[model samples]
Target chain A: GDSVTQTEGLVTLTEGLPVMLNCTYQSTYSPFLFWYVQHLNEAPKLLLKSFTDNKRPEHQGFHATLHKSSSSFHLQKSSAQLSDSALYYCALSGEGSNAKLTFGKGTKLSVKS
Target chain B: NAGVIQTPRHKVTGKGQEATLWCEPISGHSAVFWYRQTIVQGLEFLTYFRNQAPIDDSGMPKERFSAQMPNQSHSTLKIQSTQPQDSAVYLCASSRGHERLFFGHGTKLSVL
Candidate 1:
């Protein structure tokens, strides 16, 4: 079985501060890690993903490094924006033809001015 | 692109009633995925289809949940004897080559 763990229930920060949301996973085999963000009254969209090339994935100023050693793919940003307030999810899809993703509970990020 | 389209943005039904959700995947996409989202459980995988064929549905409730993708353009998920526990937002997503998934607005199902 595959599972993801997001230790933070909610992370609050002021605008321009650094942002970090913890994400760790357990899987039977090496899996594809993903970060999805959902804003208020909107669908969840892909924020970043692990690439086979090993380059850190980044989008909208957010970046994550997939560390197979620690089984972590923590999402980080140097400066938080007001629009960064949303629900963030860490997910993974195991190997093979199965494209289904196992998701973490979710972390609510609130960046205020 | 329209991304993914899910009909009946909201649905409310009584206990034991039946609820059917419709999803239209993006054109030329080869995969369609169903997921349920709730405040308590977050996002949960329900089923998926590739090239109009069922690939995996291990997350579906055996007795009450069923899904079908008779065509590449659209898919349906039906739940019989719906209970309060079934209340959640049902999201439809489509992808190509198992890459980044594009999600729909989702159908919010409320079973009372």
Candidate 2:
């Protein structure tokens, strides 16, 4: 079985501050990790993804590395923005053909001015 | 390009009623995925299809839930005798490979 855990129920930060949303996963097989962001009233969109090539996936000033040794792919941003307020999800997909993702409970991020 | 499209953005049904959700994947996508999102459970995978074939349905409830993808363009998920516990937002997503998934607005189901 595969599962993702993002313990932060809600993270509140001022604009321009650094942001980090912790993500850890457990899986029976090698897992592919992903980060999806959902803004208010919008569908969840992919923000970053991990590959077996050992490359750290990054997009929109946010970056995350897949640490197979640690089972973590925590999302980080150098500077949080007011527009970053949304729900962030950590997901895990197993290897091979059966690769549907298992998502975390979700972390609500609120960036204030 | 049109992302995943889910019909009936909202649905309200009485208890013990039947509900069906529809999803239209991207034009060239070979993979389609179904997920349920709720305030309590967040996002949970329901099922998926690859190249119009069933891949894995382990996430779906056996008795009351069923899904079908008879064609590449559309898929359906039906719930029989739906209960309050079945209330949630059903999202459809598609991808070409094991890459970034494109999601739809999702069908919000409310079982009273």
The DockQ leader among the candidates is 2
| Model 2 local distance difference test score | 0.93
Q: Model 2, residue A13: what's the lDDT? A: 100
lDDT of 1 by residue, A1-113 (tens): 88999998899999999999999999989889999999999989999999977799999999999999999999999999999999999999857877778899899999999
Backbone steric clashes in candidate 2, count: 0
All DockQ scores? 0.80, 0.83
Chain B only: TM-score of model 2: 0.98
Worst 10 residues of 2 chain A by lDDT: A92-101
Provide the lowest-lDDT 10-residue window in model 1 chain A. Answer: A93-102
Show where candidate 2 strays beyond 4 Å: none
- Lowest lDDT sum, 10 consecutive residues, model 1 chain B, at B94-103
Candidate 2: pairs in clash: none
Estimate TM-scores for all models.
Answer: 0.97, 0.96
Off by over 4 Å in 1: none
